[model samples]
Target: MSSEAFRAGDRPVRISVQIAPQHLPIAELRDAAVHAEDLGVDMVMNWDHFYPLSGDPDGLHFEAWTQLAQWAEATERVELGPLVNCNSYRNPNLQADMARTVDHISGGRFVFGTGSGWAQRDYDEYGYPFGTVGSRLDALAHDLPIVRDRWTRLNPAPVRRIPILIGGAGEQKTLRIVAEHADIWHSFVAPDELGRKLDVLQRHAETVGRDVADIEIGNELRGADDAKAAALFDAGVRLFTIGVSGPEIDWAPVERWVRWRDAKNG
Candidate 1:
């Protein structure tokens, strides 16, 4: 798929909330997912980390995929998945089957966002090999196909073709993988920087004989206002996400962005 192909489709503006699985109780996480859906966000995401990323290293934390299963059942209208599941953590086939079950649980609303593992602590604590970035990327490249294959072989297949979302912007390996496989590509780049990264992605897509435009561009929403959002929109980003970590989630920005998405999509 090419950039033109993606642009040819009706890519509407969408808002996603990343309910960070740290510093909160499971019930709070559940409520947060429910509330984000109630407020009309398009999707809800969680990060795949066994440990907290900020404040106390050993704060209240929860597993990503398991909790997402809960979110799938708890929410009626929002899409649910991890923003990027670590490819290194679980076998690709198992991951695929898990994704299939979750898609079933959600009536086919799972986005299988994934990436090469990065956090050394996640590997250290869990006893997985903490390899170099290149090695991890290599592993991701190798396993992704198997995941897709397994999705086909499952007994009762996914309710729909689960969208594969690849996160990160490593110009060489990562973007190339995105060009070849992802239905969505996510990154945390600024609007000014997004164009260049996208240009790189496009070149990679051309090399891979796929349409860069077919991959929906996704970005984070912290420090973003209407102007910034517009700039990113101009750069081809349609999925805007905000991260909320909690004892209590602040829904003010979610409400604001949901309105922004509605106005734009409408």
Candidate 2:
């Protein structure tokens, strides 16, 4: 695992909220993001999907990058981005440029969370080829360098070396990509499952010549509490994201996690 395996716990815990982009008015979504920032979340996020993942397939939806542009301007302190952008949807260079623009728009608070992409519906309905999983991952690997190089060439430059957050638990390709390019690696594994995955991630990191400790670990707070947070913390997760949907925004769980974060950090 090298020296990087246990380093994530040294950083302060961060709380993020993923406001799902479906079945709600744009105004409501905007307001929810604003409110979350007001409540002191360390980050705010939205999903990158053309259609709703649940409820109605044809429900109201907003585009990811455009909404993020708006969000960049809306919140003042919280970091922001798509929870996990589908790499196949946009050109790599274009993706890099958009990320740079958003970084500027957010005054350097954007976190580039992306994945190889799943969801056959997004591809079939949008005219993208729903190729095999291996193909999509291959696309992600090919594009990431272009994205990074584009960032280097952009005018004015990004305010900071924008953090790249890669989401997925594919022990083979995804973790390898994370080891190569990501500053943050997000996963949706159970606490019990995390140790094994982190072991896999560290082994992949070693193969890529990266110190696994250099990457921050991100996880979802789906019904998570103090105990779950403690267990994940022990397993090396530091950035915790909570998923919330709209019509009405809930604060209880968010506050609970925030308190847990502070306690953990303290």
**Best prediction by lDDT:** 1
Per-model lDDT:
0.90, 0.88
* lDDT for residue 65 in candidate 2, whole number 0-100: 95
In order of appearance, the predictions have TM-scores of 0.96, 0.96
Q: What's model 1's lDDT at 188? A: 93
Please identify model 1 stretches exceeding 4 Å from their true place: 1-9
lDDT of 2 by residue, 1-266 (tens): 32245677478989999999888899888888899998889999999899988777888889999999998999899999998899999999999999999999999999999999998889998999989999999999999999999999999799999999999989889989998999998999888898888888888888989877889988988887778877887788889999998656678899888888788778
lDDT of 1 by residue, 48-145 (tens): 99999876889999999999999999988888899889999999999999999999999999999999989999999999998899999999999999
For model 1, which pairs clash?
A: 1-210, 1-211, 2-211, 2-212, 2-213, 3-212, 3-213, 6-213
Q: Which residue pairs collide, candidate 2?
A: 4-213
Score candidate 1 by TM-score against the native: 0.96
Candidate 2 residue 59 C-alpha distance from true site, Å: 1.3
Count the clashes in each prediction: 8, 1
